[model samples]
Target: MLAEGPLEEAVEGLDVEIEWKPFELRAEPKATLRPEDPYLPEIWKRAVYPMARRLGVDITLPTVSPQPYTRLAFEGWQFAVEHGLGDAYNHRMFRAFFQESLDLGRLDVLVGLAEEIGLDGPAYRKALEDGTYYERHQDALRDAEAHRVQAVPTILVGDTRLEGVPSTAQLRKAVLDERARLAASVTVEGVVCRADGTGCA
Candidate 1:
């Protein structure tokens, strides 16, 4: 949601598919953030959180106890995307974590958001607790790693990978270029097929 420029223009005509990839937390070998620094949660609430809300829908917070299994949960969320549930949960979870400052790593928080969004809270919680989507989540993580997505807000524009929050112009250019490429690769008959059996029209 950390975006610049016209939102509609940035997303217009884009065949973008949203996925919530697992959050990877790697230890910073050279640390810069100190306890004296401003609280990131508060900062997010004041700035980034609001921006995210304006951008799209928010989703539920997960139960994060004992330790933060960010990778597992994020991958699970991404599986939801594969099954076409990304948009709904993404919007909810983002709001809860950034805007509401809720602990997204908790199951109760997740349940609350799910209930608010009219999802079956108990069923969803059971799924998470029982690791119902474990395999799917793992597969998503593998895919993300294969694509070298080490950061959030990574945009896969056709074969191009843009990491971090991209500018409106950059996103627009990517979208346009992708469209042009698709167009060029297509045939007038609208049934073009690749000799390698990779594409069809």
Candidate 2:
């Protein structure tokens, strides 16, 4: 939901298969946050709120950070993805977390969002209660570690790794350039990096 606008446009009419791998930012398994967590203010002041404003995103960060690991929400996301409602689920969750100041780290909050997104709420509740997708969520966390993803909006086209949010034009160019490079490498048989993949770094 964060970079959906540009990313969706970037891959438009392209034969790119995007894989959404979720990851956690918390260092520990059970991480809780307070209103005065010290780091939150810095991130909001220096990065998040500014980026949101620049992107014209509607977000209202919480005064008191929720206590509980985000893995619970990620597990619910696993459920949403499996049910083919990942997009709606993700967007609503974003709105809930930021705009509505909902605690996504809470199972009840996640269940409510799932229901709002037309998913089976009770089943999702049970899944969270029983820890059904904990390991699956952990797998995604492992994949994030493998990719060295310390930030959100970490996009990869072929071998090009794009970190942070890129503008619609910038993302579109990246997608087009990558498409051209792949096509040219196969068709032209001479130019390997015609689109300056190095610049994408």
**Per-residue lDDT tens digits of candidate 1, residues 10-40?**
8766665443455454322323222234564
Q: Candidate 2, which ten residues in sequence have the lowest lDDT sum?
A: 192-201
For this target, which candidate reaches the highest TM-score against the unseen true structure? 2
Model 2: per-residue Cα lDDT over 1-201, one tens digit each: 558777887788878777777877665555657657787778778888888887778776575455446778888999999899987877887788778877776777788889988999999999889999888988888888988998777987766788888887877788788877776543244534434453221
Q: Candidate 1, which ten residues in sequence have the lowest lDDT sum?
A: 59-68
Off by over 4 Å in 2: 13-15, 30-33, 185-201
Go through the candidates in order and give the C-alpha RMSD of each one to the true structure. Answer: 6.5, 5.0
Score candidate 1 by lDDT: 0.59
Q: Each candidate's lDDT (Cα)?
A: 0.59, 0.78
In model 2, the Cα lDDT at residue 147 comes to 84
Clashes of each: 17, 0
Q: How close is candidate 1 to the true structure, as a TM-score?
A: 0.67
Report the number of the highest-lDDT candidate: 2
